[model samples]
Target: MMFDKVIAAVDKKLERFDPIWQAENGVGGQRDRYYDKTGVAKWREWRGVKDTMVDYGAWLKNLASMAMMVASAPIPCLKGFWEYRWMGSYLGTFMFIDRLFEGFRGYELVTAHKCMHAIVRSLTKKIAFCLSNDRRLGGGKDTDRIVPMDEVLPPLFMMGFKELVPFPLQTLPEFIICDVDQHIEPYYIDVAESFGLPADVCSRCAAETGVALDDAFPLIGKAMISTNMPCNASEATSMFQRRRIGMPDFPVTLAMIHNEPGAHPYSTQMLKDAIAFVEKEYGVKYDWDNLFKYAKLMNEQNTIELEKWDYFKTPYSALCGIAETLYRLYAWASVNGTDPYFNKVDRQVIKIMRKAYEEKKEPFGGRTRHRAFLWGPSAVYYTDFPTWIQNCWGINIVLNMDSTMGHNMINTEDPDEAIKDLALFSEKATMRHHAVGGWDNVNAIWEWAKNFNCDMVLMNDNIACKGMLGVHALMEEQARDLGFHFIFIEHDLEDCRTVSRQDMRNCVNGYMSVVLGEEPLDPTLVEFDDSDAY
Candidate 1:
């Protein structure tokens, strides 16, 4: 399921990165960006050619892009109007706009990566198309050139290389797990077992491995770039995939910054060579200047996100629990810095808080019955359970490990600093965060959870991940020391076949109703035998 093109009909009408489309929409401008006719597209500012160059023509063309989006939006919006089933898809359209202006947050972060890329590309195309309508500069003599989609590579098909290839995941359809989760996870997971990947291996890794070993997933790129970030499984899968695809794979072994103090510096310098390797692979030169510019934007994004996080610390936030977690993933986890949407969202958050404070209103009716925090990944068993907790039980989840662990800090002054910062921060993100030492992650999760006034600590346990299972006692002890109510749930955040949605709902319902002495059962959850597919 190449969801990136699920809405291709609408996408074709609003071509991204093509100038001709914008001109047709009446916003015409210049074509050629004469400053650097190189493979990497960038503004004059990126070349250290002074950031003062006024591109009024580009502005004029963007007006046309805006106009085109408004005029063409009804086509997509109509999908939402038909029925409630299309509602998530319809709301997804709005989420695209939301992400367009505010970057990742809400539905934008929690949905499939292909869906995320599609949404972002849809905007980029509109803007690119609008900019392509240059009828102004030098009598519309030049046009901004973009690597045509047909010619574009599948971005770094793995996580670690994104620092060099900006918006790496944005270019491909991640069908292995996300867009086609139900069909792929269930089918490929079994395939993984059949292919001799020990059942004890992390299911997430096994899923990716099985797909690559059998060549089940789509071939977005001939080559793959991956890392041994926190486990050997990634290396094993990436190696097998490289062999299967008949292309060389570039894999980096991540360093624990805490133990290896020079890890960030060494990794940053190495990534420069890594970028060159990528350039050779894709036959495209690395945009070093543009990299710094993107870092600046990412730095700006991180700054605003920290400010946005402060809102949740208030007695109650309009940014409730799961919604907060969703936005957290959106702002910090994905392709955030490439656009101005994040800054716009950051500013909008200030307005939201200001209005809330002025009206003396709480995000909840009064106050949250319990201030909660998730130590592992957010729950996928029930997509709406977090919202259910907030409205029905008055419990608000303000923090989580997946989105917040490596996001506490980042640097953006220049290429080197930003690279080092990313290396350091990423070392502390994801599964790597907990691998620093024995029970170190347990304490860290508590520290951050407590920092945000989280009194109730919850975890949606992945039964298949034996590593976390080994640390359960330590995590419980830490929670007990902090005087926090800790609840560990058995379910996979990405795979629901292990535990059904109703099964989890009953578990959570028991905790909130019976354990916490809250209100009566929500009665909202239903017995969905096949909830995973939903």
Candidate 2:
């Protein structure tokens, strides 16, 4: 009885530090949950009893997915863990997920988990598939059935090859893993530098080159397809990768300034040539029926995506932040209508979004002080920046530049028309259109912000992105003229070693506190050490 009373007394005294209580009052001491300088929280965040149960259930679901990954190919997965450095980095996934949706509740909580679990389930399956067939891990029966392709290329069009699995090769070793564990890529980057690659190259490109040089990528596919869609750096890295992999590779160079009508024919022909190359190498005919089946799925997914954008323009979107961007990036680029599961997830999420809108419930319990459009490529290392900003400040990230990738509806019938549509869609791939396609595309940020009804633009200034380097003054001047609140959050894209997560937060902290003269909703988040954290 005395112990119970003592516990109650202490809880009452420390109510200010209780995340659940602080959440209700709109001034959370969220930092109290963490041990200093680490991602480790002393306890799981206490959403109210109901939401807590939901969160715990979601955690269990993810655990099950991880277990299945190991079970699918026990020996291969074991070998993969031992042979691949990036595979071990996946151990931080649960922690990374925990941090992704820290302050979520009610509809947002449920919606985020639905979207996240879809990715989680899909990723685990992909990991198993890769490990099982990986030639590097003692090639299985299905090794030659894989068609390794550039991660940036939308693999949707590759569905025409019904017999083969078109895998985004770099996604396993470099891209997605970087989002989970920030420290993993730095070693690869160092490997590339040691191999005579300059240190000043884009970290994304450098890390990919390093992954190639380190021979960490799974050996799969009879022939590989590389692309020059996103940038020159990516093209350069493709050369390095092609040499390292020693595979018969075809480079699909899409037109850079792709918006012009003239560029379509060139890009379409390139796609046709690439398809021909694949058909010749793999000895499999292209099947339009197979392509159309997946095309319809992509079309419906995109239609729902457009409808979701309408909700984003309103103040009542159930989905926002990393939950919105990360899912779109993965679904659009990686999965790309290849799976029916994502479409089902999207349907469920949209229903919840509609209900939330109908109820007029805003995310973060209506504490949103600014509805901002996050422009430029966000830091992969700090994927939860959106969640952090919402919890620490009242700024709701309404949209992200990456999410604005190719939404054009493809023709569900007619092979010729569909090929053209695919080319057009592929032209606007992630970071390709906005970051490096042309000056007009880069300058379209203001129009996008206005269309989305955003009051502020949080421009991600990737310090080493050569494409965006010279636009700093122009963007600032334009923001001033347009009368929208803008702040440039600078970070080295894939390399947190250059600009730490704290440095990125400090960028927003200075702008929020000094310029806006607004105090943080959770002041404890303003300055903290997560440098040593996963």
Candidate 3:
């Protein structure tokens, strides 16, 4: 009876496990090696080879007989044994399929499977705990313990894990959290650390099991805080500094005002126009004195009275003013050969807003949301405006519509599309323009870098995406040849928590160094000293 129940469950799962669903869920596709015929053949070949090395046929036969006996046993006497045995069988079959698929594709299947296993184990453990405690699980308390929908599912999926997991498992939060906290996080951390980060950096990695376990075992929030603290400060400071110096100066700083609330475009063409104007007005040569004068005048003209416009309406105009002011400062720096401090200006902006938001200060106005502007000599030469004035001020920059490599490509099914997309994005999105794609091959990437004169290349290594590893390696090699710096960051774009603030900072710092031709300030210098706190 026990064996019959287990088989029945497996049969049901198999019948319900749609190939279309698997394809939609990221377990099938061109990138998934297991789905391909060649990969399947290879796995079968491997299985045959492995079978010759051991008496696996006999072992399986004996196990099958025992399973049958257990399944047919009296229901009351075999309930516990059947449940345990059947669950193992279910998982073992699932893993076998996963491994076979991975072996055929020439990709490591361990990461995804480990994640699945973790989730399964976690759920089982939690159910066992709840059963032991004689407590009903539901409502807000259950919601609090539930793994975030994003955390349990792969990013490639359109839906959340809550929508994908077996209905029986959805009630078990501890199980999902445990699997991720135990299995998946460690794998990611291990891969990240293998890149030769310093011991201190490794220790600070939030995904480290030792750190996670410390939080899990004790039910302590403080352990969680300590694990994440190091990277946060490092990252924030790095991004702040990168924007300060790496941004170049241009003539006509134009920005698009997002009509929608809280929807700021990370890149805009209006700013590009301002940059172009600065370039033509000042000439190819850096003319500090005149540039500053022009910027000051522009700022004065753009400034508006607080009473005239809504707060949102004011941000665009204020952004224009800030851009003008920054240009003036950049001009001053050119002649003096000294760094212009942006921290003071930034602090002032913060101060003005703090009063408006917190203090309920009178006349809540004069606030702006302009973070930074892009500028460089490249903007000037790239323009093709007929009129000298129009050419100088033309901000015909195109925004990158698709940032992902797979999404950006015209022929995503073909591996060579990676090379094509990279070249197209770079060429189309030069200077004021922006495009996104990753490298397909080393030679293709090298060619693009040389042609476009890229100063830096950033790569994200997702351990789950086995198809991208070779391309990543090629990108690193191409970076060396093209005389550009390469910076690799580990991140799950879908799961923001996977990337700490410090990781972002380090990446930004590396990019700044490449763009500015200078070393960034050390994270340690900016770190607040808390040792003396009571």
Candidate 4:
């Protein structure tokens, strides 16, 4: 049921200090000896002697020893030596980078630890990879040694740590449940049971109760029973079979596109249409232009040049962009789906919002900020990829998708097939999905969304097939009770070019209007019409 073994391993080792930690905290005071005039002179002389050497191995060894000393030194002393604000901070940065690179490369912890030793070795290696490749360095004869720690560290750290931590843990929970709803009650109960907790104790109990159930007691009872005991003996045996053989063959009817890089004009239009529909239906006035302006400002602040909205250039920047996009997408979906739940769960939120706004009373009867207490669809989830690049650079673009619709989509469907489509989109920009039984596999997604407080679920309605649409309708109804903002955008997985510039603007603007309570702006003003542009 749970990755208990992995959790146990992490829990056990989490408390133990690595060499870096021990060196920083325990041996941080040894830097004075190195800082002394004599010590400085000795190091300088060593550097001078090393610079004159033609032997690469000797140079490498010397650097390795120095790096080892630096890595193993007390955190405070290391800081003073580097004249940085904090020694521990510097070591922490290096260790983080080392771990991240290791994770990105899919190295196990032990393997990563060993690789850290190798990096330390390379730190000492005088021949830089960059220098090795430089024609100006006179091919292999160049003796110049340099360390571009900054350039190398970020990608390594960014990629490695994400890999080390399974995608599910880092991003799940958040995206699975955008807003709470009735249809997802069973899923919530199951999750609670998995954690050995009572369903009543689950965070979204309020929403789950909306479902027509014979008795709430059974929910708690089932969870309690499942907690301390395994399933029946036959079921346990079946579990093994399930683990080894997986489910029966099911045709994939839906294609999930991953990392669909091109302009998202359709997404933009969908958002606009959704906003217009919601506003007209709900009688809510919004400021769409202002919202888009804010989005543009945010994009600029994050250094995402609208002119260069092609493939994500850097990992960090890519993550930032993805996070922004997913956040807005989720917001739009939740808002558009609000009509379904308008008389049900959403009214409760509105009541809360009004009370907080006018009466200054908290919603959910909590003392948190008014904004914090205003609940909607929100959860965290994770995604997986085959290659390290997909895992690192590509996946990060939607790091917060779990907190968005991405999590819900995966949970509701065959994750393998969904992932396959996602990957295809990343590589070739195409996707397809096969059905499982009568369900759309997106049930998992809906369940997760309900857990998170999503009343309306947002999904990528690429094909709009009957089965998939049925799933959406069911989710929409459930969201009405749970109070979701449901919305879906259409686009082909294969055609990255299908996402036009206008679509991107409309999507961003419309989503912002819904989430931020603004108007839907005209996408025509955004100038996304250029077809030849990236």
Task: Point to the candidate with the largest TM-score.
Answer: 2
lDDT, residue 35, candidate 1: 22
lDDT of each: 0.47, 0.89, 0.26, 0.26
TM-score of 2: 0.96
The alpha-carbon root-mean-square deviation between model 4 and the true structure, to one decimal in Å, is: 28.6
> Tens digit of lDDT per residue, candidate 3, span 1-534?
986687556645653233222333445321222333211212221222222222233234334544543444334213322332122222233223232222111011111122223233333443333322221211222222221111111111111112211111112222122211212234334433454433233221323322222222112000000101112322322232223223232211111122222322221232223223333432332233433433332222223211111221222222121122222222121111111222223234333444443444322022111111112111111111011111111111111111111112222233233223222321222111211112222234334333323343434443333334456665676667656655555543212244432343345444554655543122221112211111
Q: Where is model 3 more than 4 Å wrong at Cα?
A: 1-456, 462-465, 480-485, 490-516, 519-534
TM-score of each: 0.66, 0.96, 0.21, 0.23
Listed per model in order, the count of residue pairs whose N, CA or C atoms clash below 3 Å is: 16, 0, 24, 87
Give lDDT for model 3: 0.26
Query: Candidate 2, residues 1-534: lDDT per residue as tens digits?
Result: 986687567657766655746755777577778888888899988765556778999999999999999998899999999999999999999999999998898899999999999999999999999999999888989899899999999999999999999999999998898888888989999999999999888899999999999999999989999999699889999999999999999999999998899999999999999999999999999999999999999998899999999999999999998899888988899989999999999999999999999999998888889988987464833547988888888888888888888899888789999999999999999898788888899889899899999999998898888888888899899999999999999888888989999999999999999999998888778899988777
lDDT per residue for candidate 4 within 405-487, as digits (tens), equals 22111111333333332222212110111211234334444454433333333454433123344565676576566564544
**Local distance difference test, candidate 4:** 0.26
Worst 10 residues of 1 by lDDT: 45-54
